[model samples]
Structures are given as structure tokens and as C-alpha cells.
Target: MFNNAINAYQTIQNEGLSDRETEARVLTQAARRLIICQREWAQPNLRERLGDALQYNQRIWTIFQTEMLEETNPLPLEIKRNILKLSQMVDRRTMDTLTEPEPEKLDLLIRINENVAAGLRGSVTGPVGQF
Candidate 1:
């Protein structure tokens, strides 16, 4: 468990992850873990693992929300606004899942994270609204 935490911290730390590709890679990996947790929540003795994954995902979203709100962030104004809106939705969905313990509630967040990560990697060719 400690090793997992250390690795997560390392992923979010300063090993050139500021670049778009690295950022997308980290987000995709983290999102994949969260997706797995959501899918496997019913397995034997996995409740704590689900909680840990959710918390990790929450932390990542919180960081993105905070960064997007900063005055000096370089993204276009419309993009920042939309991201901030999406972040709010993530916050709400996260709280709802925590309160209700419904794994299905995580699907939207999974799609959002995956879609954004894919967009960052330049693989998305369609409108993001469908995600």
C-alpha cells in the first residue's frame, strides 16, 4: 500500500509530466485504475481498494480544477470555462457516489477522463460532447 502511494506521488511529481503527453499518460493511467475499481467493487475484500482509487481520482480532478481556475493558466478562456464546468460535475458525481456507493455513477467520470486523455493525445476525431 505504501509502495502504491509512493508510486502515485511519483507519477504526479516533477519528472517532466508538465508536458501534455506525460500529463495525458498519467491521467489515463489513473483513470484506468479508477475504472477498474468501479468495475471490481463487488469482488471479495475490495472495498478499501475501491475507496483508495476513488480518493486518488478525486485528488487528480481537484488538481485539474485548481489549475484551470488559476489566472495565469494558458488555456483559452472558453476551454477553461468548460473544464471548470466539467470539474464541478466531477465533484458532484464523486460526492454522489460516495454517498450512495453506486459503481455505475462512476461511468461518466471514467468516460470524461478517458475522452480528455485521448483528446490530449490527439486521438479524438469526433465531438467531445458525445463522451
Candidate 2:
């Protein structure tokens, strides 16, 4: 029992946060970057900040898409399909934002990230529309 406990502890230490937690953290970070740019819209570096934030969000969603597409991914088929659809929306919106450069346009992306993170963290007390 002691050896098993030690092995479990070692595994935890090596693995760190679970996949859900890691995903939630990354989503939160992406939301944070967008939020910063949204709030600092008047700043001189707003374009650069917004571009960076949008790219970061795109990268995150792209990673999710790739993971969901993997044969070994354990998520349900419906869930994977839904995530892929969502990533496509993110890609479209990101491109629109990049070309037009509007502050209000980031709102949907921010809410999406926050709501998804909340769901991943198992703290989604309300619907996505509420976020």
C-alpha cells in the first residue's frame, strides 16, 4: 500500500493538473489577453495587442481542433464534432476581427472562452448566454 501510494504521488507530480484543468487555464489566459486588449482600446499599441490576443486565441482553438481530431481522443463523437464546428466559427470571427479591427467584436470570443473555461472547470452555474 505504501509503495502504491508513493507511485500515485509520483504520477501526480509528473502529470500536474488534469487535462480539463490545463485546458481551462489556457482558455482563461486567452480570454485574459483579449480582455486586456479590449479594455485598452485607446492605447497606442492597441492594434498589436489585439493582433497578439486574437492569434493566441486562434492557436488555442486550433490545438483543440487537432486534439479532437486525433484517433485516440476519448471525447464523444458529438462533443468532438461540436468543438470542431465551434473552432470554425472562431476562425471566421478571428479573421473578421483581424481585418476590421473592432472592439465590440471581441465580445463574443471573450464570452466563448470564459464560458468554455467555466464548463471545463465544472463551475458553469449558468448557461453560455448568461456569460
Candidate 3:
């Protein structure tokens, strides 16, 4: 309950931000968390926390895929398909990391999230994130 409250408060802090800003923030936050989770994989007490972080990241991608797949979504079909494929890759990679609990396995997930975030933030020139 306390954790949910904290999360709600944190979410509320970003309530007035634009959608692009929100997306960039979410992506960056997920990537940052995965980085921390990766570094702490060897700690005895961090296993559950690591799993939760992976699941959190997965949930973010799932949301993106769901939104992109909607008929009202304005993105081109090719872009939507590409995003869904990337999300699926993230899901599979997350499961692989969760199954083996390896720090090294987080590299690809980190790269994907960071790259997508960068593109969304306009730091990288791309046809991404029109939504």
C-alpha cells in the first residue's frame, strides 16, 4: 500500500507533462532501473527486486505495443510492426534474464530501451515515436 502511494505520487508529479516527455521519462526510468538491477544481480537479497524491475520494463513495452496496435494509432503499419517486434524481443530477453538471473544478459535490454528513449527524446534522428 505504501509503495503504491509512493508510485502514485511520483506519477502525479509528471501529470502535466506532454505525452512525448512522459514517454521519454518512462523509457529513461526503465533503462535506469534495469541498469541498477543488472549491477545488483550478485547480491543475495536483490533477486526479487531484480525480477520486479524486469517485469516493470516488460510492462512498459507491453503498454507501448498495445497502444501501437490500436486502429486509431496514427503510425505507419511498418513502424507499428517494427515496434511490436522490438517489444517481443524485449519480452523474450527479459524472460531469459529472469530465468538465469545473469547480469550480462541485461545488456541488450538496456541498449534497446536506451536507444528507443534517445530516439523519442529527439537525441537520435529517426522515424520513431510519432505517437
Q: Which is the winner by lDDT between candidate 1 and candidate 3?
A: 3
lDDT of 2 by residue, 1-131 (tens): 23432343345446787868777767776788888888799999898879878987888788788899999999999999998998998999999999999889998898888888898888974433333
Report the Cα lDDT for residue 108, model 3: 87
Model 3: residues >4 Å from true position, as ranges?
Answer: 1-14, 125-131
For residues 1-131, write the lDDT of model 1, one tens digit per residue.
Answer: 43554466566656766457765665676677777776687888566776776677677667778889899999999998888898889888878877787778878877887788887777974423233
lDDT of 3 by residue, 12-86 (tens): 456987666667677766777778876666778788878777877787787788889799999899989989999
Worst 10 residues of 2 by lDDT: 1-10
Ranking by TM-score: 2, 3, 1
Model 1 poorest 10 in a row by lDDT: 122-131
For all predictions, the C-alpha RMSD in Å is 4.6, 8.9, 5.7
Shift in Å, residue 85, candidate 1? 0.8
- The TM-score, computed over Cα atoms with residue i paired to residue i, of candidate 3 is 0.82
Clashing pairs for model 2 are none
lDDT of 3 at 131: 18
